[model samples]
Structure formats: structure tokens, C-alpha cells
Target: MTMATYKQIESLMGTGPPAGAKQMQVMRWASKNPPKDPNASFSGKNVLITGSNTGIGLQAAIKFAALDAAKVILAVRSPAKGEEAKQKIIAATKRESAAVIVMQLDMSSFESVKTFAVQIQAQVDRLDVAVLNAGIAPPKYATEKTGWESALQVNVLSTALLAILLVPMLKDTAAKAGRPSQLTITGSFACQYVQPDELKLSPGEKLLEKMTSPEHFNVEKSYGQIKLLTQYVMKGLVDDYSYDVNGQVDVAIDVACPGYCSTDLGRDFPWYIALPTKLMHLYCARTAEEGSRSLVSGTLLGNAGHGKFWTNDVFTDPGIMVTSDEGKKLQRQAWKEISDICKQKMG
Candidate 1:
């Protein structure tokens, strides 16, 4: 294997299951801790982070600003909240007024994602980093404007559509800037918790119907399946653009997991689930800033980290389902299906 590939596999193998006490200690340590900034200056760079109104997305925006990115766009669902976040990032970084811009984007709707893309492409001359950080964990089964389960719509469908639209923009920026460009999507380690059977949707079956049926709908498993399927999508991206001309990928795409963080991701869930999750966050979860380090590192790692899955700032294999023979075949199949749907449904 290539050195980078070997490193990835080695990292995965080295991460054996955590011991109970050690895991607890890690959690307790993360409780209110924020990651220290790497202090990598951005100079002339422009960054776009979705769902930046709060949580890790917001902190990633702050880091990009603190590093001196010329422009940082907060692509959030609420312009008001985005503007509010913009003020905080500016004050935190002591950057200029135009350092952060607010734009509206709702991940549950393909139309909104499209409009956001068009607006950014029109306004921003370059996109050095595009962090697709907005996603949800549904508390119950619910369909969205995209006619899929809420988690699938926001986490998979709309995310893929945004990537489809933004990858070319990143390529253009890379060519112009004479440096690597990054499209980092916020992923979850929850993929490891997915049961094999949870990923068993047949290729030709109606995925939304089968996966989101209320009679059998499961919030945790649904989130897990969406995350597991996302690995296939990531594999497809790496394989599709594995080759780069002139020794650098035009655009480097990767996924990073923030570990468990205190974010609004569980906002849609019921009290019982949300309350325990909050308590866990209060006691064991990484502060949103600490979680955001993976997001920032994933964005800035450039070509060495291309098309890899990263967590805790290191490249690693996505998991067993992304490595097995059967899983690889299914990944291709799932990518074809997802791509076809994007062609049909997106603006």
C-alpha cells in the first residue's frame, strides 16, 4: 500500500475498542474542553461553513477567521442567526467587518441548497474551504421537502447535492490560488455503532419508504444508517478522483468526526432522548470548539488527507463496511443510485 494508505489503515487498527474506564476519562476530559487553535493563517483564503449558527460549525468558522481568512461565509438556515454568529466570530477573532458573511441554507431542502450555492458562487470569488457541517438526528420518523426521512434528507441527500455543486467551484479556486482546496464534510463516528442489518436496504428498493416507515422507524438506527451510507459516498468520491494532474488534487474532499459534542443536533428529539443526551454532553461531551478541531483539520490537511475519513485529526479507514468486498460493491451500487437521484431531483 502507499504510505498514506498504510497510515490510514494503521490508525484504524491502532484504535482498538476503548476500555470502560479510559473511555469514561476521555469523556470527562472533553466535557468543557476546547481544542487549541493550530494557528495556521489563511491569508487570502475564503471559507464557507454550513449550519454555522451554533456548535462545531460555528467554531470552525471562528478558527478560519482567527487564522486570517479574508472572507468566511456562514451558510446557515437563518440569516438573523447567521448574522449573530458573524458578530461573535468577528469579535472573537478581532477581524474586519467583511471578514464573515451570512447566507441562508437549509439542508433539508434541495432547492434551498441550490439557491445558497448560486448566491455564494456569485458573491465569492474563491472558495478555499467548504465545510458541509450541517446535519440532524431526528427524534422521530418525519418526511421532509425532499420526500425522505429527515436525517437522510439533511445528512445524505442534501449534503451530496451541495458537494456536487461545490466541488467544481473548489476546483476552480484551486487552479486560481495555486494551492489545494478542500471540501470537508462533518461526519460522525456513530457509523461504528450501526448494526449490519441496519444497512440492508436492497439496491432497487425504495430507500426512503423502507428506511423511514414509522412502524419500524428507529431514530438511532436511522442516524446510523445515514452515517454508514455516507461512508460509501465518501469512498465513491475518493475512487472517482484518485488521480491528480501535476501532483496535487484539484480539490481534496474528506470527512471528519467531531466525537460527541454539546450541539443542537438533538434539538428535534423528544425530552427523554434529548435530556439524557444533554446530560451526557454536560458530563462527557467535547465542547463545541474542541469538536470543531476535526472539522478545521479536515479542511486544511490538503492532499495528504485527500478522500480519507479522519477523526481526532488523523486519517483512518471509514470502517469494516467500507473495506469489505461486499461492502465495496454495495458502495458503488449505492453511489450510482444516489447520483442518479441527485440528477433527477436537484436544481
Candidate 2:
């Protein structure tokens, strides 16, 4: 068998079935119940969720509130919409009005993310759970003010910046509580389907630079590649940055994939793209509330889930592109490129 065929077989037998088989497995996934832990409690913990104004993020916020998190910070690009979400969570859970805080966080802008981090530093002493859930899948290619592609800026750079900036708080909280804190980034199952051919690179051409170029933009492909990079960033943080002064891991970093949820993530898709997605959603997609279970459950994993992927109430392999030798080399390159961008932006 060819190497590509071997990889596909390995994926099917051990890791997961290939993405072309996703439709066939949809019924199984849809029929499978989401997880619930009656004993799970976040009574005094502060849970922060970006993009909490709608969809899976909003549902996760509601779940956190219902579970009695002391504070649920809804960090969104729009404070007004966030307030509406807060009211909804309060009304649903009957939690105190003061338990939910709406904070502004514009992931498209690095400056906005920095200001929001400063506000977070001033507001809380210990952050127990932070879900970096904000992301975009624009059908059109665009660049943010930082001159990076829009998805690269929002989904990767800003996500990394916010995670690193919050590390001190996570570590401090973990040290005080004597348990590792949770840091879960919203990832996607699409990353698994990223073909090796799509990632072919010329010698000396950096992965991030090639992916972000306008000439090579394809929304679906880029989205998968970006999510693959998200996994890399999560792994890099777990391997290098999440330890405390004592050399023990103080924060658990993992990626949560809310499988094929019926969210507005493809709101801007062209007719050709949107139609098939709509059909798929009609037939197979989970509700936002159902999908949010992965996000809430992932935070409950703590240290066991560091550098792992959580979905459908189980820890599964991320993908071939995230696990193969070729992937390791590319992940190192991507991590370096992302860290450099983050350092410059943070400085």
C-alpha cells in the first residue's frame, strides 16, 4: 500500500474513520447522547467564555451558570448582545444577576484583546476555566487590522494571545487550589480531514505564511488548516508554557470539538457552500445546546486532558495531520511562526 493509503487505513482502524465517511457516521453521532455529571459542580469557580453572546458559546455559558459558577464572564465583541445572553442565562438558571459579567473582547483586533486581558486581570483573583471559543469562517478572504488574514487573526493569534496572557492567573489559581486549572480552546473535527496534499510546501516556505496568502485562500480548506494550527498551539502551550515555578503543570490545556453543530458559523457562505451545509444540518447537525456539552465537559477533565482532543463525551485522537511525523515538523514550524506573531503583538 502507498503511504497515503497506509495513513488512511491507520486513521480508520485506530484513530478515527476518514472525513469522507462523516455522513455515514452522522446517525451514530447524532443518536449518541451528550455527557452529564450530576456530581459536577463549579460552585465557586470563575468561568470565562469568549463568543458567549450566541450559539455554542452561549449554550456553554448557560450550562456553567446552571452549574453554579461563581462568575460567568461573557467576553464578546458586542457588550449589548452579551448582556442579552447574560439575562437569558440568569433567567434560565435563576442565578444571581451579579453572577454574570459582560465584557468586551474583539478578537479581530489585538489591541482590543489586550485591553480585555487587562480588565480580566483587574476583575478576578483566580480564573478556574477559560474557554477561548471565539472564531470566524468567513466565505470571503479578508485581512484584519493586524494585516494577518481575518481567520488567522481571530482564531489563532488572538486566541493564543488571550491564552498566554491569562496563564499567570490560571497558574496562580491552580497553585492556590492545589489542582490544575482548565484551558480549553474550541477546535473542530474538520481538522482531521485536512489532506496531506493541501499542506504541500516549497522549501523554505513557512506554513502560516502560505496559508494566510490571498492567492491560496479557500474557505473550507483554510478553516481546516486553521483548526489544525489551533491543535498545535494547544499542544505547544501544554508542552512548554503551562507549568508553574515548581515545574508541575498548573493548567490543563485541551481542544474541544463540538461536532457539526447547527450554528451560524457559515453565515457568510456562498450559495453553493451554504446549501449543502444547510442540508447536512437539517439531516445530521446537533443543536447548539447539545454541542456545548463538549465544551462544558472538557473543562471538567483538568490535567488528564492536557494536549488532548475532547468531543462526544470522549477523548479521541486529533487527526493524522496532527499525529504523523510530517505533522510534527509542520507543527514546530507553525508554533514558532505563531509564537513570533504573538510576541510582537503582545509587546
* TM-score versus the correct structure, for each prediction: 0.88, 0.91
How many angstroms is residue 61 displaced in model 1 relative to the true structure, after the best TM-score fit?
0.8
Q: Where is model 1 more than 4 Å wrong at Cα?
A: 1-36, 202-209, 241-248
Cα displacement (Å) at residue 236, model 1: 2.3
Count of backbone clashes for each model?
0, 0
lDDT of 2 by residue, 257-340 (tens): 877788998998999999998988877788888888778877876666778997666577778889999988888988898888
Lowest lDDT 10-residue stretch of candidate 1: 9-18
Name the best candidate (by lDDT). Answer: 2
Query: Model 1 compared with the native: what TM-score?
Result: 0.88
Candidate 2 residue-pair clash tally: 0
How far is 2's C-alpha from truth in model 2 (Å)? 46
Residue 66, candidate 2: C-alpha displacement in angstroms: 0.4
lDDT of 1 by residue, 1-347 (tens): 36764554343322322344354564564444443345566788999999898998998899999988999999998899998998999889899888888999999888898888889999999988888888888787788966787777888878888888887788888888776688888887667556566657666775545765776578757776788777866766666643356555777778888878887888877888988887787687887888888787677666667777877555655766777776676678778877787778663
Lowest summed lDDT across 10 adjacent residues in model 2 is found at: 8-17
